[model samples]
Target: MKPRLGVPSDLEAVTSAVIRTMPLDPQWDYRFPYRHQYPADHYKFTRMLFEYFLDPSFDDWLVMVAEDSLAPGDSISVVSFGVFDISYVNKRRHGPGYKPQDPVTEVENRGGKTRRDANHKHFNEFWKGQIRAYKKYFAPLGPEQMHLQILGTLPEFQRRGHASSICRWAMDHVLRKSLKDMSVMASPMGYNLYTVLGFERVGTFYIQVPGEDERLVLQAMMYKPKIWETKTTEDGDGACVML
Candidate 1:
């Protein structure tokens, strides 16, 4: 499968796939319990988040989707996707350019707070806390590093190298642009894959759910470009070694 840049038109399908694949992650499931209980509400919220990602003004981010077809067609199935940013510092500085309007005020102006509204507020706060914690500890390797915000493959399409392919594409782009490093907060399910791709574990942290007993463990991993050289020993043996 080849990896292609994702467009705004692919947002809905990609978001749906994300909703399906993300809960396969223990942390996502724990954070968004509504995904299993109230799928409709979950889908609505997920779509909103993806919409923000796909906004035209948010050009600092790159969304890559892996497609099965060799040629262009009317419709393409996105088996996997990776969201990358050239630099997190730039993203933070420019921002998404759109802030969500007050939903509670709108609802209350029309009527009283509904249970669904309350739930949405609670979940939003929960996620905001997560973001705050992430920002608190997320110190980039340098201004030259690229950040992998998220990466996932559909369950049926996983283990077929789709995720690896997308990762390789992004890493190549970073290297070509002379970026010094790449980084990601890897889930347990993806930790091994990232390691095999040469991302070294720098540290680990846990996300504390508001009222839940379980905390989500995330591995902080980083990759720096390495130079390898071929050398011949005095015995006439040749080997590849890091320079």
Candidate 2:
């Protein structure tokens, strides 16, 4: 079966997986430094963000989850997930179901506005750095490229080859569209997996909070297809679109 489509139910599980992955990732800390100080707000906004991804009305975005067919007991079934965003969707290729547009620039204000401007100041600054990086390397995403925006597998599921399932789906998706490259901003924790999936670093970017020792750094990677023709793999239900 194909990877399950991400649904509303998967939101809680996916968010948990992401939170678990945060210790190994700085990207999360970059946007959500106040998570510890504002746990309620953190989860509230995160669910909202993923909810947007799962919304069918949102165009040119794909979010999928992988199930653990053998979770035994109460272990979560949806274990791994991937999120993708296309800069430009080809009407002729994807049909009229998608929204055709150029890459966008928007910042999510985790900062509480007037009540929490301080919480979001660094958030905005971090996003500015991210926007600058994208503008420099892959702004105005074209039909020739697709972006692997986010990929996550629970820590307990790591080394189980779950991530490859998502990567395969993405590669196949790109090849079907005949797109030339797949782009991603990979964190240190994900470098190995992306490397294994044929991604190569073309550039790097970072952001650091002024009064804190914390920093966020990522490598801009593009997938180089080893073969124009897609290859089949034993996906083992690593990722399936939610029903």
In candidate 2, which residue pairs get closer than 3 Å at backbone N, Cα or C atoms, i.e. clash? 3-239, 3-240, 3-241, 4-240, 4-241, 4-242, 5-241, 5-242
Query: What is the lDDT, from 0 to 100, of the residue 242 in candidate 2?
Result: 20
- Candidate 1 lDDT trough over 10 residues, lowest sum: 110-119
Error of 1 at 63 (Å): 0.9
Q: Who wins the TM-score comparison?
A: 2
Q: Which stretches of candidate 1 lie over 4 Å from their true place?
A: 69-76, 88-140, 210-212, 227-243
Could you list the CA RMSD of all candidates, in the order they appear?
Answer: 6.9, 7.5
**Tens digit of lDDT per residue, candidate 2, span 1-243?**
357778776878887766666546766665665677767766666666676677666666778888775556755477788988764575556764645532222114443342221246566667677668877777555456778878888778777777788888888777777777788888888898888887889898877767878777789888845544334448744443322
What tens digits encode model 1's per-residue C-alpha lDDT throughout 62-138? 78888653356745588798877654446446565534233323334443232232244444444454455445545
RMSD of 1: 6.9
The TM-scores, one per candidate, come to: 0.73, 0.76
Report the CA-based lDDT of candidate 1 relative to the real structure.
Answer: 0.69
